[model samples]
Target: MALVEVKVPDIGDFKDVAVIELLVKPGDRVAVDQSLITVESDKASMEIPSSHAGVVRELKVAQGDKVSEGSVIALLEAQGAAAAAPSAAPAAPAVVEVAAPAPVVAPAPVAAPPAAVAAATAPAAGASDVGAHDPTRPPVGLPHASPSVRKLARELGVPLEEVRGSGPKGRITVEDVQAFTRAVMAGEQTTRAQAARAPQGGGDGAALGLLPWPKVDFAKFGPIERQAMSRIKKISGANLMRNAVMIPAVTNHDDADITELEAFRLQLNKEHEKSGVKVTMLAFLIKACVAALQKFPEFNSSIDVEGGGDALILKRYWHIGFAADTPNGLVVPVIKNADQKGILQISQELAELAKKAREGKLSPAEMSGATFTISSLGGIGGRYFTPIINAPEVAILGVCKARMEPVWDGQQFVPRLMLPLSLTWDHRVIDGAAAARFNAYLGQILADFRRVLL
Candidate 1:
């Protein structure tokens, strides 16, 4: 059996990052997208997934070793059923396709994964000649394509430089690459420049007329040490940048009275002390948010941009995602079907997910498919702060620490524990009046949670 070399996917702008953890060894069988190793940059870490499935024949890199895009991560010996096409007659096809040059020698998907992950690895048939993947000769000045699109390009044996991006900012998409692969299989002649067409100055960035990012050499003034930015930080930073720059966001700050609710939480904690279930305010918040979402369905909805940006996707199910702080970087692990879970159950799951996040063991699936998000800085003190909306999600609730404040009850001021709520919403999806009403309704729920029954 022939062995397939599994190479590292693009880690966006960074290079030669240290491989901090090894997830598999020789003789171990692995599946597609199963994390092969965890690589650490300066401040945080991220896992690199395997592109092919098979028995691990050999290991190419070691812990503490540096890796970059196109670097081979492992040697996989393909397994049963789907392992014959690419390894068969490798030399004859190369000799026959010599007259018309194809830069990438995309081979058959010798170990195709299940239908769920098939789109990411399955190569288009009759696309190109079978040969060794050339890591050094990547097409120069290739336009930007996401990791997923790049993965598909590698599987299809199509050079990204030769694929035109039909998406915004001349970004290449999976569909665009698929179309280009069909063209290549038909032996269509096209120039590289023609294949990578785009509007000048990009429709989005040109209007800003932004200046170049500052480049400073601090070493000239004092001694300094350089470190690579952590993988998680880099990934999250990109998302944060996109959310901050693109979204028309507005933050509405209001306070919720939770004095009575706090007392109830303490009483429940005492009753469940023997069972090891410690109820917290967040659990109650989740329940209240669900009820509030039911009251105002728009808050539980996402923008329908792909369907011509004319509607909202009101989700029938409620899955709440809460921000969990970790040593590496911030990650949000969602509690699926949160509407059906009780306060104790939600609290236990929150503790479990937070533990996994701190250990850097949370899977990508655990952090995805969130309809709404809550970023709480209650443990750590803060009055109010705006949280960037997680894309597709139109709103995020930012919870700050509670404080005892004076509230006027008719003629006299009384001390009350007020929980600050900073609700940041997309102005395009929600207006000021609706946001105010949402906060007021949520405040009412916290003041007397029995309103949820109503």
Candidate 2:
């Protein structure tokens, strides 16, 4: 058979990319164009696809191996009549009849459980059936679930086996986990109630008729040891420190009158129900930011060195990045051409990108080339926070919790929905006056909610 060595192809403008994954193993058959390995560079990630259909004979590289162009990655035995043909030579005289090729043997069948045992071990109501929970399935967990659900289970030390599946095809879903959490919380509450109902007796109870505190031993214990920060944690910690030290962050706290915006979002949600796009205040903010960026292009610019001095590099296209927190770390995935997309399209794209990010499925391309960034902590209650500017970007905006505030209306006080906006900019690229002007424009856009749609 013909053996071919698979070498790394010419990856554009990149040298020494770390291999993140190997898709094939020795003796495995692979089709043409199937991905053989994945490489991650500082700028982006790409997969190397096989050039021909063949059986993998040897894999030369493993995960985390730094490779360059023309590096041999694997060896393959090509499939075809020509590759399988024996080398040409003088024919030998036949001595006797040749035996037919041995019959191909089938794989051993899995042993089935006894009938009585099978009946006894039948799954409970709403539980996965036997053999349905295959351990050899994809390493990734079930689909269409939120990250918080998985995190909650791990934190609470809840085993997946004890939880009932409510999603499609007996798959465990977020709602199911949340339900289990609620049950656990209720059980704790009941335990507290029972403890409160128990009769109190002790020195404190005899003196003041109140419940007595339980005694505890303060014996010597083993010393606690601290470990060094992980590589990813160290990087995150350094980035946070750099942002606080270098970026001139100023918090201009103001509330936006979002009553009209809220109504408009609800109306749009009804109109776009068929598209499965839920209109949100964040989408409106994005549109308003895009408009403001167009008017004040300086806010959409980046800092670059020129002539021994820093220069502001103005970008023509608007790529707004959304900060997504994953299990491993924080990742900002950019949404390209935010200025060109409508509210519905923006919402849909944001939802999909956020889902992918939380699942660690976002590629490096999605994490790079952001001209601006927006971080929203409004979902969790907070008045305002001075968010750090993402490096290379001139400006970053933070949206805080929107709440009802009492305001003076000429004659009387009135309650109105107000949202806080915080902005941080690079002082090297943008001056205080320019930053204030940009913030003022953003505030005005947010105040004039109808203008966002136009």
What are the lDDT scores of the predictions, listed in order?
Answer: 0.72, 0.64
What TM-score would every model get versus the actual structure? 0.60, 0.49
Candidate 1's TM-score: 0.60
Clash count for each candidate, listed in order shown: 1, 0
Backbone clash pairs in model 2 (N, Cα, C under 3 Å; residues 3+ apart or in different chains), count: 0
lDDT (Cα, tens digit) per residue for candidate 2, span 1-454: 6788777776667799898667678987754444577677645456675655579999999999998888888998887643321422211111111112332222465443242233235442343333222223433222222223333344344455555454333344444544444344222222223333444322112212433233333334655655656545556565665455445666556667776677778888888788788877877888888888888888888655331234567899988997776766777888889989988888888889989988878888888888889998757888788888886577899898888889797998888778888888777667788878887877777777666656
Model 2 — TM-score against the truth? 0.49
Which candidate's TM-score is highest?
Answer: 1
Model 1 CA lDDT for position 202: 13
